[model samples]
Target: MNHIILGNSLTDWLIALAVAVAVAAGLDAVKAILLRRIRSLTAQRASRARGVAVAALSSTRLVVLAILGLYAGASLLALPERGQLFAGRAAMAALLVQCAIWGDHGVKSWLASPRAQQAEDPGRATSSAAIGFLVRVLLWAVVALMILDNLGVNITTLVASLGIGGIAVALAVQSILGDLFASLSIVLDKPFVIGDFIIVDNALGTVEHIGLKTTRVRSLGGEQIVFSNAALLKSRIHNLRRMEARRVVFKLAVNHDTPEPVLRALPGLVEAIVSEQPQVRFDRAHFNGMTAPAFSYEVVYFVESADYRVFMDVQQEIYLRIVSMLAEQGVRLALPAQTIHLEGRPAVLPVPLPQDERVAA
Candidate 1:
């Protein structure tokens, strides 16, 4: 038992190995017991913190815990400087990676809370998704740096090199980067969201998806239109879904021969038709002006509903009523016609002589 092996007595080696195994077993038992308790709590009443704890604990690999135990036991041994350094670095790397895993789980659980899932408030949902992505990237980046530092890497030099290389990469993919940032802006600014009916220039559609590079819209024609996020942000966007009411203006024309009294009563008649319609507010009706061939009246009203179908139905009903009213009043709609006066005698056509008469002559 007094014989030395690797600078330690055989008995000392056995003690160290026994301690490593004991610690590993203890950690495994503890992890299992804690998991059972937390899971029970989760089943009783779910919470974001508890959910994150479950996810993080589940990600802790048995091998990582065993390595940690071995490192603890090795600390008591009289190992060489290099062996000690290697063990310490290995343990530290495993710990950093485990912490990163926990952080990742926490971020996902936090972002998936009820507040973040509100579809009615799309700005919050979009912001949460983007924020979660950025946080995970930052978390992993820090973990990588810490691991590299433990391995005795000179990070300052590496970071400076990456900076120069990053510039080159950025220039190569500037347009893609522009679109990514534009997508970020859309999430933050929230000009439009999924299910919003919007018009971008001549293209009108409902937003279906917003992505890093493009935004997809389902058009009225049932075709999907894709727009680059950068270009989409540049164009003017009309979010019709946000409108409280639709303003409608229409013009009516009556023949020039209409009676003066009938013309005077036309405005009130049309106003009555509009006011009687459901979901509409009549604004004004007036004898606008006399055109070359007819008298024109302009009518304006508002449809209280933002739905296009509702507006159209209301408009159609009002028009039909107006036509019926005009018929009752014995008024005819104007038609395009032109009148001209002869300032000189009208030209007469001469009759053509027959061919036989010309031969006899």
Candidate 2:
């Protein structure tokens, strides 16, 4: 049968069909082999690159391969000029779409890989969600532009229009856009992360979640506080969780008439008390000055812990020991007192006296 259809003989049409099917089946077989090999390599070495390759290959659809095979078959035919051009464009579009799929799979695989999960900085791992989403968006946008270009579209003018429109939209939602960018900066710069104890101005809390628009903090008072990312970044943040040690300074007073020897020994006694406490470093203790009511002394130390509870416990123990030492040394803690003289009369004392006259000699 020498009859021709669409400028190709019936036998030629059959041969092209056979080639298309054979090519599709062969490609599918090769994909299976490559996938298996790559998976084995990924399992053995735990490499993110190899794992991404395996995922990308796994996403290779049979339908896409069939479309590619059809495009290859079309090359063997005496197609019209328009038909040939359309076939080439269709093949290119398919190829671009397949590449986009592979890229998407690779990005997701890399984000979920063991290496990412095991990163030393947990901020990097947590930031992967936003990073992956952005990478996929760019991948698809580029693929779409490539397809449009392949179809003989004037993408340059289209891209220019999109840029103008994007600028207009950005201005319209500038507040929202600011928050988004601020969130990106937060994740990348990592001033604080989830579970960090932070004080933003006066609001103190543990960071619960970081989102594109806001960050949620669970406050010490058991209420949830939400801060807009843009506003949050503008405020001063004190990340207490990162503190290596906590400094403590306290003041005590002694009676104005205490013996000089005892007053001098007081600093050394306070130093010994602070040094004996666990997780504490004694900084200094001094009789700084004398006030009208008492001789004031200041003591300073550092707790080698960021935990508030530990600091409080160590401080309580030190205070109790200081009181015991003062009692044993017969040091009287100063109390406010005053003496007044009535003309031609004994001075009237304001200081409290137990079972004694209200007037002073």
Candidate 3:
């Protein structure tokens, strides 16, 4: 065995191993300091150093573990110096890149999780999650390309081939690609979110699932409908989820013979019903011109909630109260009727019919 000894008995190989370990430790410390400075500068934090230190400590364990893996791989190649240099360097590069990327994603996800955030706004939370995922994907892609180039691969030639292939693939799957792109746009642009009720073309439903090719919706008619993302993106979309209020309009007609006092007080009575309602907003009430034997009035109000049941309840309450109020005011509802007068025609017609029958007898 060719073994190195310490002091008088120590040899060259032990010293080299010690030197490599020292170099790894120093590099790790320096990397931690550099990352801390970079994060501080970008985040504009001075007192956040402790938090950075804590994050680095946790991340360092993962990093150190990766370095250890590289060193072990390198040491095994040490039998041949020239071959070891190339093999060891490549392995070290791969390990460092993988670990760094892993740490970045790990730290960011830990921070953005609801468990980490003290207070969260839903809009900000969703946006951050989406952006974070995209950023992580891009970072890894860049790292992968860099590693390939380091391995002496012809990146330019590869890119060219990929581009040509991509064109053909794109042409073949143009419709599918369009839908995928549209889904990406939906994620980024955020016109609507999950659970939103929307109307697109003849389809009206709640958003159940969003996918690359198609978006699934559950219609109010107890049916599920699937739409191509490209088609849904092209259609005129109406989101009822964002509706502020619901409006109701109806006409009421009172007898023209009703008292003038009741006619004048109708607006105030209608307003009272609207104002007292739990979630109704009074818009207007007008005494329109007489229609034949009745006087017409148009009433309009808004329901505060988009809920159908709530709107119906408010409307029913108002209707019952309005009917009672009209009764109290002695104003009756109009009904269709006709009056006819018969004069002097019955006697002469009956005698002529009877005379014909008597002659036959």
Candidate 4:
């Protein structure tokens, strides 16, 4: 078929180019349709990432078909190195398969795991996806090394040289590697998972994501704080999300005009109010003694819900009831105030009735 007819001594290059383009286009269409069918079948069962990965790998079939078509056309035209033409195609397929493996296995599975379940962050997710892609690249290095060795490259010598150089390289990145490994520990130990409302040192936030070398926290005020995994692993993390209930303690001032009889009755009233609440438990209420312009009673209770709004609602109801009861007993709550004087008219009275009065009486 080496008949030089269409031009000045050439085997119809225009026809070859047209044929290649047409074959590539046909292969691309076939791949698109085939992937749609395969994915439709896998849609009901496989995880999203895995399904996408499978589809992506299937699409690479077009490249394979196009290359085969080219080789076939070339062979008919008596082209050179036809055996090695298929070698490059095989390598390309291996590379694609490697990527598919990472997307399907390493990354997608981690994303599917409960340990990685976090509050959605558009930016943080993009960052995590980038990191996942990088990890896959590192994994691809291993695959590439294997493929090179299979192609008759000297692996042992190459690996030895790389190992020597990698030591120094590793030294430079030791801190990063430490954090990465710590992140892995975080995933495995799972002392605190994502979406957990945690306080690490002074940083309080809901966990946004756990990444390769850092854990991201989205604060209550809509700020993002990135903590190194190493520091996070060592620090004290108070996970409020895991708490069954939150303990709240505060002092409610009693009216100075409230007599000792009413002050004594106050504890029972507070207890009754707490008892009526659904999830609030009464602790001891202490008559914490007289204060500046007011007598203070320390009330302590545990709320059943960790929700801040719920705690506030319960607190308001309990206090409102206490105020109504105090009014019934002719007691008004004392406001914070100070007694100013132009001159010292009279000294304050000493309480607890000095023991000397007992003997004198």
lDDT of 4: 0.72
lDDT of 2 by residue, 1-361 (tens): 5789999998888888888898889999999999888888877778868988988999998888998888888888899999999989998999899999999999998888533553365576658877888889999999999999999999999999999999999999999999999999998999998778999998999988888899999999999999999999999999999999999999989987789999999999999999999899999999998888899999999999999999999999999999999999999899888556468878778876765554653
Which pairs, if any, clash in model 2? none
**Alpha-carbon RMSD of each model:** 3.2, 5.8, 6.6, 9.9
lDDT of 3: 0.73
TM-score for each candidate, following the candidate numbering:
0.88, 0.87, 0.69, 0.65
Q: Is candidate 2 or candidate 3 better by TM-score?
A: 2
> Total clashing residue pairs per candidate?
0, 0, 3, 0
Over 1-361, each residue of candidate 1 has an lDDT whose tens digit, in order, gives 9999889999888888888888888988898999999999989998878988888888788888889889988988999999999999999999999899989988887777734556677657667777788899999999999999999999999899999999999999999999999999998889987788999999999988888889999999999999999999999999999999999999999998899999999999999899999889989999998988889999999999999999989988998999999999999999888677678887889988899997887
Residue 8, candidate 3: how far off, in angstroms?
A: 19
lDDT of 3 at 304: 94
Q: 21-50, model 3: which lDDT tens digit per residue?
A: 766777677767877676667477544444
- lDDT (Cα, 0-100) at 231 in candidate 2: 99
For candidate 4, lDDT tens digit of each residue in 83-173?
A: 4555555645555554556454646445443324324433334345645666777877777677777666899999999999999999999
Estimate candidate 2's RMSD in Å: 5.8
Q: How do the candidates rank by lDDT, highest first?
A: 1, 2, 3, 4
Position 205, candidate 1: lDDT:
96
